[model samples]
Target: MRKYALLISLLIIISAINLNAQDDNEKQLLKQFHSITSEEMSGWLEKLCSPEFNGRLSGTPEFVASAEWVASKLKEWNIKPAGDNNSYFQWFKWPYTIINETGSLTLNLRLSDGSVIRKNYQYPNDFYPGMNSGSGEITAEVVFVGFGVTAPELNYDDYKGIDVKGKIVLMNRDVPHTDPRNPEYKKWVAYCYHQYKLENAVRHGAAGMLYVDGASANPNITYDPSIIVCGIGPQPLEDIFAGIKTTNKALIEKIRASFKPASFNTGKVMTIKANTTRVNEGRACNVIGYIEGTDPVLKNEVILIGGHLDAVGNAGRVVNGALDNGSGVVDIMGAAKALAQSEIKTKRSIAFIFIGGEEVGLIGSKVYTANPSFPVGKSVVFINLDMVGNGTGFYVSAGSSYKEYLKYFEQANAKYIHRPMRTAAPEAGEYYGRPRSDEVVFRTAGFRTMAMWTTEATKKVYYHLPGDDTDAVTIDIMEDVAKMIYLALTEMANDPEIKF
Candidate 1:
């Protein structure tokens, strides 16, 4: 009698737990289905992007801790690791570091007679170290390398016959210019100059580059505000100057003789007596976890949802990013939990991948596509959420092949979601070429992918700044977005009838 009672009690407890889980997932009004409200997202973002999380600097102790927390949460939601390795995080490395500087640079000029003259500046106060990586101190003559280019297209080769192998190359900015579509200024080929410069500089073994102002042909041309100013690395700066057609190029070229050939022992180098580190070795990682499928035929196929979970941490720690990404992060986590409780059994697998090293470039996602935990070709769709906005309607831009599925998603959002989320046929520009998020990586590999964003230039001012904290996110908005995402996932996951 005692044994039977114990068995009955155990069965009762198991049934109660299952019932509670079902209750949590039951669909309801605006406030009901999204038990994981925007409030929860905001709250989680507040905690994760908080100073206590040490800004979640990628690769730091804080970053690792954050990863652990995320993985733990996924496990709690009952999601299982699908990788053969049995781990969710596919870790990769990239060269990186926090900026630490001491002072300005001094140029020691030595005449043919061996006599030396010392010239130095008080740092950015006088001059700034161009984003070129540092090399040890050197003393050599400087040469004017026009535009620092080596483009064979326009028959331009600034590095031609120039032995910039060890000496510094003095070059002008993009072009001397007054025209965006200037033919002479190489507007068409203008954008290639920056990369051409770096590639040529690295190829010819140039020590460094110095951009003496007055390069622009336009004397009044100030820095371009349209250019992004993120702290990740050189991309932001390059993007800013990419549009700079001319900056008094003639003046910069003329100043070549006046560079005063001093020895630059500036920045972190061997003789500078400071520590210098590089992302000397780093790889990308696609943070991954999945809720499995139940259908026999589609069980092997997978549906992956992802986000570039990295940022340029230089935006004040306070840009603790309540919205930039903390909101997205919270969105994924909350969705994982809610879906785990859904009575709907997916016919195909569903993966939630958070990628790292996005801010530095598309480093993480690119790697994941190249080496995915699951087969990339078998993937039916890649859903990416980046910088979603408050309760306002949203937009989804998908691959050329996924137009039909995109319509379905739009319909679902319209039906259950209070916010208006629109869908567009995948094309270029806003949907494609732009390097806004990790979706590009999957798309490049020929996977059917869709990017859902609040739409750039449409977000709050704090979107990319340090002020992007939890206080700015509305829980109600999150709930709505969550419902839409949940609805789409369920429809796609269970619909064995879904085709390209």
Candidate 2:
């Protein structure tokens, strides 16, 4: 009996020693993460969000300069350039559109009584030109296609038998009305993006598409340049449906009550002419740097860390975008600095990228996914940091999809920072078929993407406004976030069992 007891005691001692060793290793990692201080993050944020950067609009000199600054910082940390031509920039051109002052929209409805009612809609108030609208003119009969959805899977087709060829089609903003509390409501919202609607219109050979604002529609909407697509406000839409027997309110209620196609001819001929200028402002770049892994086999795979480096330029004042994405850029820089300076060597390669043209519509990330520096199929995971310095705690967008990734964060939170984790549904920010940031691009590219940010509701008052300056970013919160990111990256880099 004494011999058995001695053996049991030995086993317990061995286990305790192993646990202690693991705890010591975790402590060392935490110390390395702390090497990226709040002061360094603050300094980086100040420089990136300053007025001299001119809000870092993509395709502009200011934006390129910001990318250069990020490349310089990466070089300082001894991170090797992972971009094209042995440089830190993966350059690509993007098409941009600007609404010139000459842009106008005129609606004329011919009455059956041999008289015509003409109305000229003012710019911005009544209607605004779509960012991707092509310059053209069309005068044809208008067709009312409900919701403009062509979902054959759902047995719901708005253009089932209606011939919309060479005629303007007016449609509502969202899918046929469903209860907001229903689980399918979010899915419907996702499907109701302008792209789907425009595609539907194009498939039906419509000459032009006009979107009427529904109850839940976004006031500001933009779409790709396929055909001439335009948005008409409620007042102008009401004017268009004035003499028709069915009112806009009645039509909306009818469609909402029953999820069915409400297609009809307006019996009124209308004219729509859209003229805008397209500027191909050369090319912008995604700045990339790498820290190669030690393990021979696993080094072939990559873990991507990225943040957008562009903002909404100027809105009569400098949109410093300190909290929008300036904070996110600094957070990535902090992670890069921490990992580069530490002695810990990852098992898989880690790539740091600052994506440009995110503000305009995730253009940079889309371009990268299309033409990647490395094979996207070999990418193990993607971690996106956007607006991370706003609130007190951290929240992972799409947390449910990456429960394994969240385990490291949970462990790190328990040991180092006890900040509470806020839960956000994966479909929260996805609406109108558009992702809220660059993370969506990676997610669509088949990468397991995770986006970390602060409590957005608490900091949304200054989110995209001119007031989103340095004052909106909390330094301590940013530091804590940086540490959490570092902990997660270290854990991911060391663990070989984690798969794509």
Q: State which candidate has the highest TM-score.
A: 2
Model 1 lDDT-worst window of ten = 216-225
Please list all clashing residue pairs in model 2, or write none if there are none: 193-432
Q: Global lDDT of each model?
A: 0.56, 0.76
Which sections of candidate 1 miss by over 4 Å? 1-32, 52-58, 101-148, 158-199, 202-276, 279-284, 315-322, 428-436, 456-476
In the range 305-413, model 1's lDDT, one tens digit per residue, is 8765654443113335556566667777767767777766678888998777655556667778888877877788888777664446678787777787786578677
Please, what are the lDDT tens digits per residue for candidate 2 over residues 329-372? 88888888898887777888899989988876688888888888
TM-score of candidate 1 versus the correct structure, residues matched by position: 0.67
Residue 233's lDDT in candidate 2: 68
